[model samples]
Target: MNSVSRRKFFGLMALGAGSMAMLPGMAFGAAKAKTSAPGQTSLAAGQAMARIKALIDELRAEGRAFAADALASDNNAQWDRLLNHYFDRKGFASISVNAANLCPSLKPVNRMAALVRDLLEADISFPMRGELAKASLGHGLTAVKDWFGLGGSDAKADFLLALTANSTMGNNFVNNGLVTSGFMDPQKDNIVVWDVNHPTNYDAWMYRKATQGWGADSIRILKTKMFASSVTEAERKAGTIPSDPQNEDEIIAALLALVDERTKLVTLSWQSNECGMVLPMQRIVSELRAVNKNIHIHADSAQTFGVLDLKLGQVDVDSIAGSFHKWPCGPKMVGILYMNNKHGAAERFTPSIWGYDEYINTPADYGFAASTGTIDPNAKRFSYLGQQNDATLVATWMAALFHTGQLHPGVTPAKIEARIHYLGGQVQQALFKHLPKVFPDFTPKTAAQWIATPTSNARLRSSVYLFKTPDGIVAGDVMKHVYEQHRFAIANLKVMGHDLLRVSPTICNNAKDVEDVVAAVVDVILAMKKKTLANNTHTRSYA
Candidate 1:
């Protein structure tokens, strides 16, 4: 087939048009073109052509200099220069920081664009496309294992599968491992979740949705006594109780109390999304296992995956779900689900979608025969979805390379973790010292009162930090002002009824960026306060 026909053929296949049998006289490499054809100018064909043209146009429009620099660079200095150039090109020339929600890096985008450009231009056949897709998936899986510090021989013990996003993986675990596995009693069984801090909607809300119809009492939340309102406001007024409390012991006790023989599954984020509070996974797992050995434990590693040095071989969880877009600075619409296959954990959950490996169809002697094929007892079972974007998988591998220092030397996981923590601590200390100075009337002058994130315990610190806005000022308004006025990107979120502003600095940021962010926030807060006071005075004058 020529280039145009090949493009159209693949586009039609993507649009669910029938096989080659339907396209009469469409030979693979025919020298003569047939003037007459069967429905060659149909609407579906025109739509397919337009879609392919749009994709090609997009690929051509994206910047290719980053990819070119990466390919040409031979030394660490060159790679560093390329990295800076890439970030600047992505509109991060200023003090923008939104790594907690989504990374602003362009490494994954460049890699994906390059691969997609080549694939679209090449006259690749269907069989070759399948080979390339499987190869990309294999490479991506290997990179994921390496990110978790797993050896090649450990592939059978641990399996990794890709999904569209983190929420899909979380929902899969809840539906397959808890509800559909026939382990829950609905009346007696309940799932325990750390409810003090706000986990991602994927973790908390997914659990709620999964166990919705079981019963009103099917879900049990474990929270700190301080967060659960066990302390009175009178005590807070008297300064007898710490406004911000590091009640890990209380949280653990509450979690243990909630877990019993009836508890089926326990799920929580490895790091709290509201305020970078790292959960004590070791203690939680060990103690919970003592209560019920058959209990299933799941960790949503969205906030911890690429920023934290995690060795899955040492972690004793049944499953972990994480996304690459946040900390890893990888492509969007791609996430990973890791299952422990050594302990038969992978076999417990059935495939949620019927992919290529689900079954086999054959013709019987008399009629038709359809038999169930041997489902892969590993992560491959979950990855059998009909079609997937191969370029995205390759881009994931490229991101892993960039993160692990293959593409950028001296950028190992340890250095990345240290850099992130250092930046987070800088922001935390700056806010703690400056917020009180700016707002002298702000009561309860404690780090815990203002900084919603736990800072008393060093072990619980993470790259993500949250600050409670001053009274009479909305966090969302501050967030918008900072971004719109100063070109700074931060997050303002309402978690558990408390409004807080979040700042997360990643590998793409520097100390200068941190200083600028702090100053911008302070400037915004003071300006907003002055405006509010003037408005109140004008209202009084008019009255």
Candidate 2:
């Protein structure tokens, strides 16, 4: 991975965030415990689960000891006493010891208690279980207070819609369906609901279940592919599919045409395109607010949780949802949601199947709402070798604290985004120069140039650079050429209507990495060109 050039980063950027798993020698595949098929016993899975449980129990004990040791070292400091009171921890005056070991810069007095809290949190942050628990608690509490004002109400609002789709989680807002629907009703303090997006698609299926609309149509909008009022017999014969964000907007527009404004919108956003483009939710919210004053915006930042600086409350984002395992390195399945006090109940959108406690009349009313029965009892749930949700949540919280300490304050989501974009642009340039020989149209185009076409400009620049090759050249051809022949890491791009080579870069990518990828792409294009020329010559001679 070292000595790689910026060009290689471009290649990675094309693959987008979703393509992270496909990288060479750094496959993001989950190391699930080897298990037997459904009919066979899963001894391996069982063992893995047992091991994880044992580790969790040990960590819990360690955490307790650490708390006690820190408290005991406090030396009867009044500040330590206050923290114990506020946080409700029974351990001795641990604040003094924590101040001594964790952060010495602080005065160690009452004024520095917050710093101590942050530091102790940082120390315990490595194992995600506890941290993730905090996140879940935060989300739950925010849900209650945001939806129902400061007091619990017996009256329930009309809807509790959760909109999630694509990078909605990254952007921390429900932009897809909520924005597409045209009326932002969630923010007006009426309903106890939340709009969220998973990095994976979750809400679309829920929508299908609720609306009884065509599933293909729903997916087509999210993928941003082909667009038609209806897939005609001829179009089906031709193998058309909607695969662009604009197509999604069109689908939304269509849905809006027939649906009522009162209809609630919920969706999950992830892997919309290989570009791995995160949602620009704050901007979307601003735009949405102009049209609908009441629209609530609850975003899912599962992928961007610890990696990106998300001031959800400051940005007027009502609620935020996220899973801990992806970037923050927290325990698996740990997710959190942040609620903005200003947005109020328009952001509380819990699933109805999850039994609603009478105490949770709205989002702004309470800190805890014990609603259960939301998930399928027998269905597959979030588990990394059977780790318990509580433990996982804690681990995620620790990861967040650890990563937050590591990142430079200057680094923002916008910066990471620019870096990836720059890498993708460079790769596209290299490919444009090299691929001319193989396919006449192998000219690499910038995301701007490719997406700027009449149909794409109004939409996002597919986070991955999408360049069209010759009409007949399928995405698989380019993918195979890069991965097998050239050994350059890249992914197939079949987003919207364009066949593109998607490259994506993440925090791990640097300028050199980008160059290595581009150089390989250059070589592949040259070889392909030579082969194309030979084939053409042979065809001419035969004719």
Candidate 3:
């Protein structure tokens, strides 16, 4: 079963237990039979069916009432309403069509739905990240070679390491077998390991700081940051800069300063919150090249991928790692890594099990050789196929074809981004109209503003709109209420160290979906208000 189904099953079990406790008379027990005959099995079966139908009817009625309340009360602060009320219908339709197109081996009908749920429920963890690495190892290495201007034997060795690293689980295979063997050591530390300075730098600092007798003098740290100096003229004119400096140049400069030459350096950047955030990565790339050609530039464009049309050549980026599932809405297993020709530090430093002598300086043989056996067995195991691989493949291909055909590659990302932005604006407008009645002084200006109100910016992505309820309601509880009550499946953004309802609209959704989700959120908020008032009265009476 998919994660969502498992959750639902658990919910039902809990609810049934709770209901039994609340109403002991309705608890499971022997019931009176109409026939009063021991052999009347058929009659018993019919009676059981009738009971089941009645239960279903009751649930349906409850669901209708709940949905109506959501629409009438204007509680758009909940996650379930955002997901189920808005896009669930279209998603269900797509899933149904995809399931039918799938092969018979898999329980196509349920399989498609399960896959969809799995995709939604999948955790953003190392396992998922590793899967992405496994799938794009070869491509990443190739991009590195292309970016770094590596050629001849050097390029050939780099390709081999790429293959080995792709196939292997760790860098040991590449380091010992490739670098120590003296077959690929020439390019070690020269390719400039390009990566965003995130948890990597933070982790490294934490580790170093934790070490006993560690001093600043012991480490030669050069802080060269890459950032925009100020917000752009347009952003200033638009009055978009609220608090933070939106210039990419200053941001990059700050990032560059944080880089310590004692170890590998990674630079990080986020999408421009204001229109003027300019990334000086291209300039940084150029400066680093002129100063030291060996530096490898790893770019993490996970946040910027679909929103921006990146000019790979202009930026002089050596290696790039991105999450496809985020903005692209592609298969969960997919991600992209671009590397320059000269950037083969990992392969040059890490070696494979096979001796380096067997593989020569050639892209084809070395390319496949480097990454032939490192993939984790469990990484691809338990795919949410549910036995319908063929139908799934066809459906996935069809979705790609349909979306790409209609949207076009060059235009798809931009168009979808714009639409999401507009939808977010609409949601904000709706929230402003409803939130103040329940939450006075509730002025949600932008998606970022809403998420940041509770310092949820670290966890919530730009694509999602998230906000906390005034009464501190858990996002999961609100999500359940919305889905079970409205047949919608809005998701919660869990990364920001706290729970908040997330509103994410993809190509499958339109303005109506956005509005519906907003309406549902409003309903949730109103319901919360009612519950609070009732609880307050009860407390007063007790006192």
Report the C-alpha lDDT of model 2 over 1-543, residue by residue, as the tens digit: 322332243223322322322111121234454544677432342232233333333433433332332222112242233223223233322211111001111111122223223433433222222222222233222232232232232221112212121133323233333432334333331211112123234444345335633323223222323322234334333323233333444333322232223433323232233334344455655654654555454454544443344554445655555544333333433344344444443323322222211111222112223453232111011111122334332233233322222112222344433443444454445545555644454333323333312123323321234344444445446555656654544555444345655454333333444556656554555555556522121111000
Give stretches of model 2 more than 4 Å off: 1-280, 298-308, 319-341, 344-348, 352-395, 406-463, 485-489, 496-499, 525-543
Clashes of each: 1, 113, 80
Which residue pairs of candidate 1 clash?
1-28
Residues 286-342, candidate 1, lDDT per residue (tens digit)? 888898988878777777778887766667777777777788878776777777665
Error of 1 at 2 (Å): 21
Q: TM-score for every candidate vs. truth?
A: 0.74, 0.45, 0.46
Q: Model 3: what TM-score?
A: 0.46
In the order shown, the candidates' Cα RMSDs to the true structure are 10.2, 19.8, 18.7
lDDT of 3 by residue, 1-543 (tens): 554454344334333323222111122333443452764323332232233223323433433433332221122333234334323454352211010011111122133334333432443232222222221222223332332223232433223222211111221221123224333223222112222223332234334334423344332232221121234544433322222233334333443443334323333333321111224567767755554565545555544544343556456665444433444443333333334433543432322233311111112222333355432111111111121222122222212221222112222333444544445555556656665665665554333334322111221123344455556555555555555555455654443244456555544444566667667766765675566322121111000
- Candidates arranged by TM-score, highest first: 1, 3, 2
Q: Which stretches of candidate 3 lie over 4 Å from their true place?
A: 1-246, 260-263, 267-295, 342-413, 427-438, 444-450, 453-462, 493-498, 532-543
Which runs in model 1 stand beyond 4 Å of their true positions?
1-86, 93-95, 106-109, 156-158, 175-177, 196-212, 224-248, 356-375, 441-445, 532-543
lDDT of model 2, residue 361: 20
